[model samples]
Target chain A: MRKPPYPTVLKPYGQALLDLAKEREEIVCLSGDLTRQCEIDLFRDALPERFINVGMAEANMMGIAGAMARQGLIPFVHTFGVFATRRPFDQIVNAIAYPSLPVRIVGFMPGVSSPGGPSHQAIEDVAIMRALPNMTVIDVADAVEIRKVVPQIVDLPGPVYLRLKRGEIPVIFDDDHEFFLDRAQVLESGEDVAVIANGMMLSSALLAAEALRGAGISVAVVNAPVVKPFDTRTVEAVARGVRAVVTAENHTIVGGLGTAVAETLAEAGLGRPLRRVGLKDTFAEGAKTAPHLFKKYGLSTQDIIDAAWNALGRTDSAPTAAPTPAETGEYAPV
Target chain B: MPSSTTTSEVSISRFADTIRLRAVMMVAPQGFGYLGQALSSAEIFAGLYTHAYRPGHDRLVCSPGHYIIGAYAAGVEIGLLPEEALLTYGQDDSDLEAIGTETSPAVDLTCGSLSQGLSGGVGLSLADRIKGEAGRRVFVLASDGELEEGQTWEAAMFAAHQGLGALTVLLDANDSQVDGPVSEITTVEPIAGKWEAFGWHAVDVDGHDPEQLVRALDETGSDPRPSIIIARTSTRQGLACLPEDADGHFIKLPPDLAEAAVQELESRLA
Candidate 1:
């Protein structure tokens, strides 16, 4: 309800990248004419010689990154999520991921974060990049996590597709929060229900968990940042003990965090009743703000709360939180 | 015809002829390969390996993936690959597959996907420039069909924009694609002009002439801008001695016709 304290989450990412570049000369920054949008201008400004602006050509940027990686320089490429993943999928898969090159493809405006709508949203990046043999996929929850995760992947080998939130994001984690690659962060622990979320969706999940706790529901929130190597061990342990499960994300429910959790639980034979909250097999139309789009697509904290209650078999019977906008009928169903 | 051919030029021409013959012979057993494309690109490879590309120092990238036979034959000539391994091409458990990738023993980078090698070459050249490996040039052997890909133009733009003088692209303008002639499928004509417009020092040469190709490739590097040698060639340049059926873009070389083609190349080399 209040204004987010952070003006832009991507500044930390840009600062982190610049810091990394300062630490290692092998670190080179590249952009697809999104230096300002992706907040890579800081890196560009600091290390002008190492920064390469490849213009609007995503595929060429990827190919050049692959070539740069081959030359033993670590190239961190930034673009719109869709352009970074879908437009240049072949170049990433063949030239980068297939060869296990260490080209970090940082995709901003992931999922429904892009107000530019379907063309710009990278809803399927996680699914596609997850399918790659040697790709490491990570969706950071907040700016604090971004500052920690961005620098860690520099030393790691092989290709990495990092989904990021760009401008004016809510701050979640504290300053001392540390990040580990391929590890899940358990934000809150409870016995009755487990809510697994990633990227900006974790903020909503935290809010939903707070409201659920006020209702004496005792909900657990797992920040599943490393989406690809899905942290099956942690997810399995959480799903095994929890009474019910709810997975939320800003991406399609088909292959994002929801699917990752569902697959992990199903493979582990946990048989816990699960609810997936995300874009249901469709595209997000252009909207004025991300929060309105979230409320429209049933991704707001209220949606997560409702899904949690439904997963617990309570339905709409017992609810103490404020009313959701989905009940208001202002956002017509697509 | 341009100048008096030296003994080394004659030897490099023989190497190219052997590459063409080996490509024909290797594809004959399988009955399927990019024989036409390989034949036209042989002299480019020979000119590069013999004149420009240093075995351990410089890097050569094959962007036209199906030209694996030419790469393997040239690899044999340069002692990077064994001649016995040529027989195992397109066969099971062989390092030399029908398409060349960075995984292939002799290949420095992968290229099954088109329009990627020039960018890769640019990366290598850029790395060379940064690492102070000044004389270590990066050579890319691209195809006419690959120019149809938008990434090729993007790479062309990037190479010139970076002023990659150590990068030289030998475009095998073999005039045909798998579908049809390159013009009919997609008009990449004004090809030299396109490269020049992209800030490359574009040079047009006869692709099949080892001497001219050697000269063109030799002269392509050391310019301030990225250089491109558009080697104008036929799709099936060397197999003209065979029946017309042997000249398709992707041909299944019948055993007897394949033999005849080899003999023609052998006699030419002799």
Candidate 2:
């Protein structure tokens, strides 16, 4: 993982959207009274005519987005993660996903990222979006992925659910990083343990891998940003090459990335030892900080290391805690 | 109504009868379907398709899936769909589903789910406006029962707030839903005042009266606000074949009843 002093970009999603909208006249942005929160203010300021503040009506906003897509207008509907996926699920299914419309559902504050408790935290968004047919699900890791993802998914040929982090985004990947909609990147490959992670958990998995490498336990680290069109060959290859596998995500273990990998492995009949590191079938409480929720919800670097240790059946080899990276800025993946 | 998706060569009193007759023909084969919905919404379909709908220009957003029987009938009358297609309604592997779906032909977007059509109407209209084609129109055929869905009001508030003048909602105010009469379930009465309160040009009209429907629908963009014609209708508007005790929401046409219903609609058409 990149150390602190990692340059941060504020509202990377908003900037990317604004930049994209400038090039594509058919791109329209809609906010459900979450204009600045979801970070489309830049687009609104630059291209006011293309932006719509659709009030707090999430369901109506989804229907409107679907209808807009039918007219060849790419509508990016943004809101807090919870309202974006759950509250308007039926609308998403009926108007957007059902007909395979090309509306981009941009949801901010994924999982325990929000301090607004269960109401604001989109703990189950990935699962909800993953379950829908014709929905391309993505959870971008950093500024690079966000910028690349916004433009790439525009021509996805169907609806896409994009899970993003608000505020200053960490620059995990380099400026020239390439992102594919159906590929998972193997950050570091090792033989003993494979850690397939995405979103906020990628950094933690990297830190865990670093500590495991130091402990003489080889670990493989993979970043799976796209969850639905899950790169089965990559996931299977990574799992097949490792003694045990660990799936980490900033979401509930059920029906999310973990479940996707689990389904893939089981279908492929890869009887690899698996451990999932995420919210363990539980709702997160309101906390002052996301790291605190991560630590409390068993989603920290230490937890990933412990899960790896547990998966490897190394009960005697007590897992060591990797130095928790100093949250150098206002936002840092713990 | 250049909703761009209607495929309507767009109806009259005779057109209204044509729609009712087609609805019977579609449902008769199934022996049961949302035939009552088709009956109640027949004239609203006829009035809009005859007076407003323009094929390859106008779009029709059918929110209530059950009303497709009437819509398909209107489609057949407009020559967009084959009349023979009605016989295949509810048959195996038919696109003519008992309830409208995305595959349902003729309409722009067909949702069996309630109250979603209005939002779609707003979206279609809003999309046109965003694309600098604000004059392109959409006629949304919704059910009164869907007013119970919160999304209906949400769409209402948005459409009116946006001044979607080209969007016309022909609400079939048939006082019946699945549970019995809509008034008995959740009264969406004072429906006009309700829409007006939401900033719409509300007009309550007789669903069966073609003249009233034409006038009400014509006022859609007359004053630059979204227009709604709440056509008050009944499940038995054009069908006298059903027994007095028949369900007024979804009708079951067991062979004899189906035969009788078809004969009655044919007689009216003749």
Say which candidate scores most in DockQ: 2
Q: Model 1, range B24-129, lDDT digits (tens) per residue?
A: 8788898778788777887888888788888777788888788767888888888998889989988898888888866586667758888888878877777676
Scored by Cα lDDT, where does model 1 land?
0.82
Judging by TM-score against the true structure, name the best candidate.
2
Taking every candidate in turn, the Cα RMSD to the unseen true structure, in Å, is 3.6, 3.6
Q: Ten consecutive residues with minimal summed lDDT in candidate 1 chain A? A: A325-334
| Residue lDDT tens for model 2, B1-270 | 333323332337678777777777777776778778877887788777777878679888999888888878888888879988888887888888888887788788888778888889889998898888855778898988899999999999999989888888888888888888889878677999999999999888888877677667777757688888889888887788777666767788898887887788788767
Report chain A TM-scores, every model. 0.92, 0.97
- Residue-wise C-alpha lDDT for candidate 2, range A289-320, written one tens digit per residue: 87789989999888899899999998776567
State the TM-score for model 2.
Answer: 0.96
Across residues A52-152, which tens digit of lDDT does each residue of candidate 1 receive?
Answer: 89898888888778888888899999988899999999888878988899999999987887678789888888888988999999998777888889778
State every prediction's TM-score relative to the real structure. 0.94, 0.96
> Which residue runs of candidate 1 sit more than 4 Å off their true CA positions?
A1-10, A318-334
